[model samples]
Target: MTMFTRNDKGQDTASPATAQPVRSDAQPAASPVAETRRPQAQPISSSSAAHGTPSVSVISKALKITGQLESTEDIQIEGEIEGDVRAVSVMVGANAKVKGTVRGDQVQLAGQVEGKIEAKKVILTRTARMSGDVVHQDITIESGAFIDGHCRPEYGKAEVKAPGLKTVVAGS
Candidate 1:
């Protein structure tokens, strides 16, 4: 039982050696005063000004989302999504599952998608399994990918517009 007990002293001692480098880095910092002030401000409040927000949002493998997801920045999904996803760039990870439409400037899928994909550029990787139509200005379907619906190169075409919108007169 004594042998099984953790020996944390070794790790604690090693931590000081690593900490010395950080101390040395702090000593030569261009703005030491600003760096000290930033830490003080960070402890007072957790704000985006202290640490900038990420430009890309990641949906981890453990997550399951059921509503529409819209973002101007890129999105990486490794979980399950049951509703529409719209982003500047969307990446569906190898094990991700999406059950609704995905719209983006660029879309890369390596997982299972059960609905339509509309994008300027679309890529289906070897392990991708798509069960619906894909509308893209440019598309690449890898050799081992599985697709059950049509792949149409008509992403930005007028025909892809809403059905009633095309029939409506501009002034009326």
Candidate 2:
């Protein structure tokens, strides 16, 4: 990314187009002086990371998912879902009711789910109810949630079956 910078005197610096590092054959590969000036990432200890991942947000009530929902950004369902949902992060709302499968990087439920769920992270919130299986890398369930069926941290694609037997996807 190129940045437009201003000097302390409020004068515009030279355009980034003219700012190019000159190539030189004398340059050495990997210098400790340059390395020390940069911040390094320390390896995380085994214990802390083993605990679990974190959540971005929660679902309330109002929104409704009637079909397959797919995205890469984080999402929270606040109303009802009648079909599948796919994303990087997902949350079933407190008053939400999902009747189909959900596929995401992370998924949480606080209302009701009747189909399978596939995600990296899965959470069943308090007052949430489910009647299907959950396949994910991580899962969390608060008190008041009701669940039925299987719960697998990892599973195959063959195991994920959406209910209601739809033949085609929307907007195909």
Candidate 3:
């Protein structure tokens, strides 16, 4: 006599050997549907909506910067800067203040600058208050603008070096 035996209902179930195998061709047919369900991701573009010009860095009125700022793009300042600023294009907004020099390809001022400005083109609006010298290839100063230092059109030109300054003798 056997110690164990299968029940009547259990013996009616299908065995593993009778199970059907999956076809390899079915995988390829379903791949296109899987690909269509997945969404294609894209990269985010520029932040500014304007074209032809790159993104601009804005210095708001409530902020203040103590060190030098250098950029290859444009900059708009409506706050206070204690140190120098260098950019391709620099625009000083009304009521802004800059203590050090500003150097750019194009510099537009409508505020106060206690230091010098060096650029290819400079425009001083009526509300501008500049206390230091301006060196530019071309400059435009409004009638009401206040300037305490000389405006020299000597940018990009070979000018006489100041005394007591070390001059670099190139090709030596």
Best by TM-score: 1
lDDT of 1 by residue, 17-93 (tens): 33332443435333333343353464456556567656678999999999988776789999999999888789999
The true-structure Cα RMSD of candidate 3 reads 16.6
lDDT string for model 3 (1-172, tens) is 1212222123223323212213322334344333432332213544453344545679999989999877767789999999998878899999899999998889999999999998889999999999999998899999999999999988877772221112312222
Cα lDDT over the full model 2: 0.61
Between the candidate structures 1 and 3, which one is better when assessed by TM-score? Answer: 1
Displacement of the residue 159 alpha carbon in candidate 1, Å? 2.7
Best by lDDT: 1
Instruction: State residue 113's C-alpha deviation in candidate 3, in Å.
Output: 0.3
On lDDT, the stronger of 1 and 2 is 1
Question: What are the models' TM-scores?
Answer: 0.66, 0.53, 0.62
Tens digits of per-residue lDDT for model 2, 1-172:
0122112112212222222223211233223223322332234555444455533333347565566665545667877768776666677767778788887766777778888887767888788788988887778888777889888866434654432224323332
lDDT, candidate 1, equals 0.78
The pairs that clash in candidate 2 are 61-78, 127-144
Query: Candidate 1: misplaced stretches above 4 Å?
Result: 1-50, 161-172
- Please list the residue runs of candidate 3 whose C-alpha ends up more than 4 Å from where it truly belongs after superposition: 1-54, 159-172
